[model samples]
Target: MRGMKSRLLTRREMDDLITKPDLPSLIADLENTPYREYIIGAKGRLDGILCIEAALRDNFTNTFRKVQDFVRQEEAERYIVIFLHRWDVQNIKTILRGKNIHVTSEEIASCLVPAGEMDEATLNELLKQPDVRAVVDLLATWKIPYARPLTRAYPEFLKTKDLAVLECALDRYYYDDALASVNSPGYNNQIIQDILRLEVDVINIKTVLRMVRDRVDPEEARRYLIGGGRVFDERKLGSMLCLSSIEDVVKTLANTPYRFLADLPESSIRSQKISIIEKELERFLIRKGVGAFRLEPLSVASVIGYFWAKYNEVTNIRVISRCKTADVSPDILKEELVYV
Candidate 1:
C-alpha cells in the first residue's frame, strides 16, 4: 500500500496535467507518469475524455485489486472488502441512474467501476436488463442482499418515479451492513466505524442542503436521512432541515466539525452552489483518510488512506481531462479538483 501511495501524483504533477493545452496534450503528459500503461492501452480503442476516463478507471480498479491482494490477514481483508462494497453501491446507482434516464447500455457500462464484490459479469448482466424494473427484478431473482431494500422501495419508486427512494435504500443498506460487519471490538474496527460515521454525516449534510434548496418539507426530508452518523443525530439533522435556506442550514453547523461549511464564501452559499460545499466535505473526508495512515500505520487505516489518495489522484485526472475537452480555463479546472 505504501508503494502504491508513493506513486500518487504530487501537487506539482497535478498542476502540470491541469495546464495541458488539450486532451491530446494531457494524454501525452500522462504517458510520462505511472498511468502510462493504462493510457497506452486505453488510447488504442478510445479518444478524448472517454479515453482518459477509461484509463483512469482501469488504473484505479487494478490498483485497488493490488491492494486487496497485498493483504493476507483474513480480518484485515474483511475490513478492506467492506470498504470495497462502496463501489458496488456506486455501480448499482450508476446503472439505476442510467436506466432511469434511458441512456444506452454501453454508455452506462462505461461509467461503471467493477472493483467491488459485484464482478464485471454481474454488472454486465444488470446492464442487459431492458429497464429499471427489469434490473431490480433480476437482482431479486439472484437473491442479492441489496435487492431486498430495492424491492421494498420499488412500490414507492413506482408511485413517485423518484430514483432517490431506491438510492437511499441502497445507501442505508450499505452503511448498516458495513457497520454490522465491523462491529467487533478492535482499534481497526473503530477506525473503520469512525470513517463510516463521518461518511453518513457528509451524506446527510448534502441531503439537507438539497432538500432545503428544493423546498421539500422537513418532515418528508427526514425520511432520507441515514442513521449512525458521527456528529449529527436525528435532532441535529432535523434542526438543520427546518432551516429556510442552504446558508441557514450551513450556519447551523457553526459549532460542529463541519463548521468549515459555515466559513465558505457567503456568495457561494447564497447562490445555492452546493457543489462547492460537497467538494469541501469530500476533501474533509480525504484528510481524515490520509491522516489515518500517520495515526495507525500498521492497521487497516493505511489501506484506507492509500485508497483515498489513489481515488483522489484518479478523480483529479478525470476532472482535468474533462476540462481540457471542454476548453475550460485551467484556473476554473483547478477549482474543481480536490487537491488532498
Candidate 2:
C-alpha cells in the first residue's frame, strides 16, 4: 500500500485534497444528495435539528458502509475530514453529554470524527477529567483568540453547570475568535464577517431568551454576550429585557431580524438546564444554513457547514439510540427530537 499524504488546508480547499476522493460530478450532486437537502428543508419545525440528525444517523449507516467499501477497495484512509478548531465547542458539548450519562469510554468512542486539530484521545481524556475547568485545560492546545476567550471565561463556567450558560460562553468564545481571525485589513470579505456576526446574533437572542426565562439579571446576561454583533445592539438587548412575559420577548424579537426563533416555544421550557434547547436550535441552523455565508464553488462555508452538520448527525444518533434503549415511545421521542 502507498502512503497517503495529508495537505495543509483552510477547511475549504481540503475537500479537493481528500485521499482517494469522489469525483467532481459525484460530489456536485449535493442537491440530489438526499440527506443534506433532507436536513436543509426540515429546519422549519422545532425538531428540525432532530430530523436532520435522524437523517444523519440513517445516513451514517451508509457512511459506515462507505468506509467498509474503502477498505474493500484498498483505500483505508478515506474518512470524513473535519476542521476541529471551528467546531471544538460543539465537540466539547457532545463529549460532555456522553460522560454525563455515564456512557462507557469504549462505547462513546465511535461518535468522534478523529480529524481536525484536537486529537480524539485527548478529547476522551477531557471527558474523564471531571468539571468544565478540566475540559478547558485539555483544550489548551487550541491556541487561538477563541482559546483565550474561553480561558478567560472558565472561572464562571467552573461555578455553574448551567449547561446553557457554559455552552453559550464556549460558543460565544469560538465565534469571537473566528471573527477576529477573518477580519483582515486588506481583505474586504463581507461574507466571512456576515456568517460569524449572524451566528453571534442568533446565539445572543437565544441566550437572552433563556436568561430571561431563568430570571438572570441584565448585568449577568451581559457576560454571556460575547463579541459578534450588528444585530444585537444595546438597544435591542435592553428592549428584550424590558419585555415581561416570555410571550412579549417572543413578540419583541419578532420585530427584529431574529424572528426566526420567535416561533419556537418561548415558555419557561426554553430556559431548561438539562435539555439545553439552545444546542438543538443551534445544531439545526448550522447544518442547513448553506446560503447564509458567501463561499462559492465549494468553499469555507461548505467545510464549516459540514463540520456542524456532521457532529449534529453524530449527536442526534446518540440521543436517538439512548431513547431507543430506554424504550421511549415514538410520540414522546418525537416531542424531544429535533426531527428531520
Candidate 3:
C-alpha cells in the first residue's frame, strides 16, 4: 500500500494539468501519467469531454483491479467491494433513466461504466429492457442484490411516477447494505464506518439543503434521509429539513463536526447557486478522506484516500476538458475543480 500510494499523483501534478492552457495541452500532459495508455487509445476515437471520460473510466477501473491484487485478505476485499458498489448503483440509475426516456441500446450502453461487479455484458443485457419497471424485474430474475430495493421502490414509482422516490430508495438501500457489511460485531471497520457515515451525512445535508432551496415539503423530504451518519441522525435531519433558510441550516450545523459546511458562500445560496455548496461538500469529503489516508499511512484509510484523490483527478480533468471545449473562463473552471 505504501509503495502504491507513493506512485499516486501528488497535488503538484494535478495542478500542472489543471493550469494547462487548453484541452489539447491537458490531454498531452495526461499522457505522461498513469492515464497515458488510456488516453492514447482514446485520442483519435474521441474528442473533448468524451475522450477524457473514457480515459478516466479506464484508469479508475484498472486502478481498482490493481487494488484488488494488492489486498488479498477477505475483509480488505469486502471493503473494496462496498466502495465500488456506488458504481453499480450509478450504472443502474443511468440505465433506468435511459430506459425511461426510451433511448436506444447503444446510447444507454455508452453511458455505463463497468467499474462495479456488473460487467459490460450484464449492463448491455439491462439495456435491452423496455422500460424502468422491466429493468427492475430483470435484476430480480438475475438474482442481483440491488433488485431488492428497486423492486420495493417499484410500487412507489407506479404510484407517484417520480424517479426521485425510486432513486432515494436505492441510495438508502446501498448505504444500509454497505454499513451492514462493514459494521460486523467487533470488526476494526471504524475508518470504513466513518467514511460511509460521512457520506451519509453529506447526502443528508445536500438533500435537506436542496429541499429548503426548492421549497419542498419538510415532512416529505424526510423520507429521503438515510440513517447511520456519524452526525445528523433521523431526528436532527428532520429538524434540519424544517429550517427556513440555507443560513439557518448552516447555523444549525455550526455545533456539529460538519460545521465547516457553514463556511460555504451564503451569497451563492442566496443567488440560487446551490450547486456551489454541493461541489464544496464533495470536495470536503475528498479532503477528509485524503487526510485519513495520510494520517493512517498504509491502512485501509490510505487506500480509500488514494481512491478519492484519483477519482477527483479524473473528475477535474474531465471538467477542464469540457470547459475548454466550451470556451469557459479559467476562473470559473478553477471554481469548478476540487484541488486538495
Candidate 4:
C-alpha cells in the first residue's frame, strides 16, 4: 500500500498532464507513468475518453483488490471490507441510474468499478436484467442484502419514477450497515467510524443543497436524510432544511470544521453552483482521509489513507481526460480538479 501511495503523481506531474493539448497527447504522457499497462491495454479496445476512463477504473479496482488480498489480520480485513462495500453501493446506483435513463447496458458497465464484494461477473449479471425492476428482482433472488432496501423502495420508485427514492434507500442501508460493523470499541474501529460519520455528513450536506435548489419542502426532504453524521444531527439537518437558499444552508456550517463551505466566493454561492461546493466538500473528506495516514501508521488509518489517495488520483485523471476531450483550457480545468 505504501509503494502504491508513493507512485501517486506529484502536483507538478498532474499539472503536466492537465496541460496536454489533447487526448492522444495525454495518453502518450500517461504511458510514462504507473498507469501505462492498463491504459495501453484499454487503448486497444476503447478510444478517446472511454479508453482513459476504462484504464483508470480497471487500475483502481485491481489496486484495491491487491490491498484486500494483502491484509491478513482478521479485524483489519473486516474494516477494509466495510470500507469497500461503498463500491457495491456505488455500482448498484450506477446500474439503476443507467437503467432509469434507458442507456445501453454496455454504457453502464463502462462506468462501474467492481472493487467491492460484487465482482465483475455479478455486475454483468445485474446489467443483463431488462430494466430497473428486473435488476431489483434479480438482486432479491440472489439474496443480496442491498436487495432489501431496493425491494422496499420499489413501489415508491414506480409511482414517482424518481431515482432519488431508490438511491437514498441504498445510501441509508450502506451507512447503517457500515456504522454497525464498526460499533465495537477499538482505536481502529473509531478511526473507521469517524470516517464513516464524516461521509454521512458530506452526503447529508449534498442532500440539503439539492433539496434547496429544487425547492423541496422541508418536511418532505426529511425522509431523505441519512443518520450517523458526526456534525449535523437530525435536528441540525432539519434546521438546515428550513433555510431559504444555498448561501443560508452553507452559513449554517460556519463554526464547524466545514466552515470553508461558507468561505467560497459570493458569486459561486449566489449563482448556486452546487458542484463547486460539492467539489470542496469532497476535497475536505479526501484531506481527512489522507491525514489519517500519520495518525496510526500500522492500523486502519493507513488503509483509509491509501484508499482515498488512490481514489483522488483516479478521479483527477478522469477529470483531466474529460476536460481534454472537450478542449477545456488548462486554467479552467485546474478549477474542476480536487487536489488534497
Q: If scored against the real structure, what TM-score would every candidate get?
A: 0.97, 0.57, 0.93, 0.97
- Put down candidate 1 lDDT per residue, 1-340, tens digits, no spaces: 6777888899999999988899888999999999999999999999888888888888888887877887867556876788789999999999999999999999998899988988899999999998889999999999988999999999999999989999999999999999998888999899889999999999999999999999999999998999999999999999888889988888888889999888789999999999989989999988887777786678888888887788788888878887777889989988888877
Candidate achieving the largest lDDT: 4
Model 1: weakest 10-residue lDDT segment is 70-79
Better of 1 and 3 by TM-score: 1
For residue 301, model 2's alpha carbon misses the true position, in angstroms, by: 4.8
Full-model lDDT for every candidate: 0.89, 0.51, 0.82, 0.91
Q: What is the lDDT of residue 67 in candidate 2?
A: 34
- Candidate 3 residue lDDT tens string, 118-141: 988898888888999889989999
State in Å the error of residue 28, model 3. 2.3
Candidate 4, 111: how far from true, in Å? 0.8
| Candidate order, lDDT descending | 4, 1, 3, 2
Candidate 1 C-alpha error for residue 254, in Å: 0.5
The list of candidate 4 runs beyond 4 A from truth reads none
RMSD of each: 1.2, 12.1, 2.0, 1.2
Better of 1 and 2 by TM-score: 1
Error of 1 at 305 (Å): 0.6
Show the lowest summed lDDT stretch of 10 residues, model 3: 293-302
TM-score of 3: 0.93
